[model samples]
Target: MEGHPPGLETVTLPPYSPELQPVERAWNLTDEPLANRCFESLAEL
Candidate 1:
């Protein structure tokens, strides 16, 4: 996977366009590892 990790797990956002808004790229970068993750309280998080 070190060769290219994005091909497997990348959650591709909208079609990347240089002409788009200031948001360079928008994707849930923390979706997998953070999935089903919770804290008993806000302080715990």
Candidate 2:
């Protein structure tokens, strides 16, 4: 199992609109590659 190191603290940031998230936009723009390519095995995926 993994153990956390000493002196760890969580830092919170101000909430931002989802529209500002680049990842979300990228996901929305990109089509599902898995669906387009048929992979029968886990290795292929």
Best by TM-score: 2
Clashes of 2: 0
For residues 1-45, what per-residue lDDT tens digits would candidate 2 score against the true structure? 236577776555459756655577776456566456777899877
Per residue, candidate 1 scores C-alpha lDDT tens digits across 1-45 of 366656575445568654464453434564666679987988876
What would the TM-scores of all predictions be? 0.27, 0.30
Model 2: lDDT of residue 17: 58
Give Cα-based local distance difference scores for all models: 0.60, 0.64
After best superposition, candidate 2 residue 2: deviation in angstroms?
Answer: 24
